[model samples]
Target: MATAVVGGRLESELVRDGSDRTKGLSRRTVLGTIAWSSLLSACTSPMTSSGETPAANALATPAAGQTLGSGSVRIALIIPASANGNAGAIATGLRNAADLALREFKGADLQILIKDDRGTPEGARAAAGEAIQEGARLILGPLFAPSVSAAAGVARPAGVPIIAFSTDTSVAERGVYLLSFLPQSDVERIVSFAGMRGRHAIAALLPANGYGTVVEAALQKYASASNSRVITIQRYQLDRVSMQVQAEAILPVLQRKEADTLLLPDAGDAAPFLAQYLASKNIRQGDIQILGSGQWDDPRILAEPALRGAWYPGPDRAAYSAFAARYQAAFGAPPVRTASLGYDAVSLAAGLAARYGQQAFTAQTIANPNGFLGVDGAFRFLPDGINQRGLAVYEVGTGTATQIDPAPRTFSRTM
Candidate 1:
């Protein structure tokens, strides 16, 4: 039998002595003796129950002969499989962050486990079950909204906390905490900043998807809250022809209404085409200031001349330069944007483990008011498990992103 007191809790289990199961004292008695010995030592010793051994007190080492438990704290990194190219790259970056965190917090006995959700709800549920079976106390992903929702359902009952990478606020509930950079916060920050810069009239080109819808709503809300007006709202499919048509239609509205700012939320894959279409319309980049979400971090936007002077809100890239350098050195490539998300997630988990131990590594602790800070930014988890983050504004100038506002400030959300 083996006994240990971990995080101020007594745990005992019977074990065979080598190949001789019947030899020596009874396993239960041995375990009981070990527990009693530990408790007696605690009474006589000045050590804290949280495992903080005083540097000067050398006699308080090893809990006076009680052996440490062999159980490992499992952490799952759930992401879409290798099929989706962009998602795969993001997952690789997340894995790299996990590897880095393991090296940083080596004393926690943390064991990272990877689970591919395959970008499906069913796959997420199965992956979550596998993680639980392998004894995972914390989960770090399921990049997509549907998968995050499904994985949260499976982990909640088991008291495991999930640090999801999905930007959708709806998926953040129960035991799930969003660790991704959300577009709504970015929209609010950019709109408020632009408003402060005297850009009153705003127009938007959004995709016909849930994410785009959220961005559109956020733009409208923020515009009204900031005392700015949204002159035109145009929706477009991902197709080039559809985007061209929408861009042309919006160009006439912008010209007529004289809107100075054009907000575009869908900036991936469609950014270059949208930029080209806007350029063809003779709508110079300087004429109308382009406001974008964090999605504008893609390098493709930098290549477009029409995207110059575009402003967006995102994580502080400068703060993560060292992390990116180390990640690239180890993984042979720089981490994707979501890699910072993973690093933050692991840091959050390690902080919780250090502060509250294994028992405190639950859903409620993640939703604490004084939440953990990471490479991305300062975030506090709400009661609903959604992380509220402050976003910094970045401006694209001469094919480079310039930090206009290095610090994130509070904005009115009344509208």
Candidate 2:
């Protein structure tokens, strides 16, 4: 159910006119990011004393000692508040998660200061400045990639650490940590799974974009490390006109039987079309095993006959279901997948309060080898500031997917 970025100049033109098509694309992108969040939120069991998951309290009662201790930690939560869009909804989920953490850790002296980024790079910088002025020690969010980059420029100079929510890895650096689901992690998981199953000759049909470049590199890296070879790597312009041509190009490689697995890292909607196109050329799923990223979790993808038995790595649904139930009960609606990120970030800070004092986002603690359990299983930040997630493998079936390998509860295999 992932909505990919509309291709190049066409998308830019649509944005200028505010066309209905662009609006629809925007909605789909937001939905994709939300679906993206489920992969991040699919973690271990609740971390509450009563064994019940933390939810928004009905009384709205303030926790004991709201203004206690001389050393109070102010965490700035920056998100797009003015825009009644995805970021705004995500911000609400973040606030709820922060509030839940505050209640869960009553003794911790912490305060969350919410700021609106206005969904612009300049706005992000302004928000970061405001957070610094308000004496924030750590910052969370400003979702878009440009905003994350702009916000980081402000936070880095002031020696403040940021737990940004953007999926773009380019923004990650020393003081800025990415808590978003990365395509690299998705590739590594699925590739490693394929390698273990003795299906190593890989062929990729990747989108012609930065994200595609990352996954392409990942496929090469994993293939090389596993003593396997990449048979063919085909790049495609993600448009209707270019799609047929791209599918046609792959027909030769499929006909030659150069690879055991075919990687199609496109949206679920595109899967059926690609499958059918290839099938029409006598290149069916029976010819080669289909592999995909976490974005292929949509049920609609399973309905396509051509994609039956396709394998992709995704978040643990059982874990996500539990978290979603609690979120829906508290917020009166289900949260998008990424709501767990805000909850996890604040919860991490609160959990570290005992060991790291008011400022708990130090590099040493943040890069703990053991990693921490969040809504999205076990995750830990690498030294480079990119976070790695524990993911599971699933095989697409009729109307649904069945989990084949559960996500690791620890980072033993991950590290």
Candidate 3:
């Protein structure tokens, strides 16, 4: 029925890339592919030496929200932990993850005051107001786009920055950062990779939805940079017959080989159906390379056989694998893909607070062009509040994704 505050952990070292850390590995210093350090296995209670830090569980928040940590620099983590459906589970799991991140980091420069938005915009606004009132220097999450917008309405005027978990690009701007994976990155990575392989022209079968719209816009925007142009586009509803119709419509383009690559931006059965439809039409195995977005990171999509050589872009698989193992060991359960967002947000807060002092949450400090590498490889906040990550290109094999390109250790340009 009310907001709650608790105190929590901090990592002492600068964020490191698992693929690039030269000092080798140590349990005390690990935050990369290994996911966590020995803190989870070694420390039973979170230790904040300042003696003023609140107990880890001082109170319960509205709905199923939880609060963790207590220190001078307080940050708020707003999530829909009590919402209906799988959202509650995902939020709670990730909520615990924020706690785990600070615990593993080994210091206590920050306290996370968590609030539950109950998956509603109004709730998010109220939560943000409470967090700012409680002296929180930063805000993290509300999960969905509407919630992010609502929270931003309150945080923006108060001069508090937000690091949201939504994948929607529309919610990104100025002081609000999206920490989730964006499909546009997939578009850029895959399209550019294909261009290098001598594939310059592209054909696409996009869904008639927002996801499709975002990918399409990215294709157009990155055309000049990637040296790849869209030759044809067929937008279809997400149904078997609709996909077949679109496949048929795009068949002529494929037959002419006008487009060297075909993009199927939808996941689940969409990619499989479209690819199989083309195969049924007697298209040669190597007639065109099928391109996909990060949505294709599913096992069923990878093992669908029809999409054997399809390529997609996503976070570094190796680092995530290692992070998942350590997460399971620390919490006794595996984490969802988005759990990295929560962990990284808290780790970012800690890393900044430790080094930047009171200036930790400033826009200039958070948007470092070099970016910061976490359990999910490297990512940095753009000035526009959207984020870009160092994603790897993966080629789908039999029930596996072969990493064709490693994620960049650092960002290339300061966009």
Predictions ranked by TM-score, top down? Answer: 3, 2, 1
- Lowest-lDDT window of 10 residues in candidate 2? 22-31
Judging by lDDT against the true structure, name the best candidate.
Answer: 3
Tens digit per residue, CA lDDT, model 1, 1-415:
1122111111111111111011110001000011121211111122222544333312211111121223265677786654343555555667666655544443445566777776678888998998888788888887777787788888988888888876667777767877765666778788989998999899888887656777788888889889999998989876888888889889887777579988876655686678778877787678888888776766677666788888887766645665665455555565554566676676566555655666757556677654444555556677787666666777887667888876442222210
Q: Which stretches of candidate 1 lie over 4 Å from their true place?
A: 1-73, 80-89, 116-120, 272-282, 362-364, 409-415
Candidates 2 and 3 compared: the better one by lDDT is: 3
List CA RMSD, all candidates: 15.8, 7.4, 8.7
* Residues forming the 10-long window of minimal summed lDDT in candidate 3: 5-14
lDDT of 3 by residue, 371-393 (tens): 77776667778899888777778
**Candidate 3: regions farther than 4 A off:** 1-65, 413-415
**Evaluation by lDDT, superior candidate among 1 and 3:** 3
| Model 2, global lDDT | 0.68
TM-score for each of the candidates: 0.73, 0.82, 0.85
Off by over 4 Å in 2: 1-71, 105-108
Instruction: Give Cα distance to truth, residue 9, candidate 1, Å.
Output: 47
Compared with the true structure, the alpha-carbon lDDT of candidate 1 equals: 0.63
- In candidate 3 the C-alpha lDDT for residue 197 amounts to 82
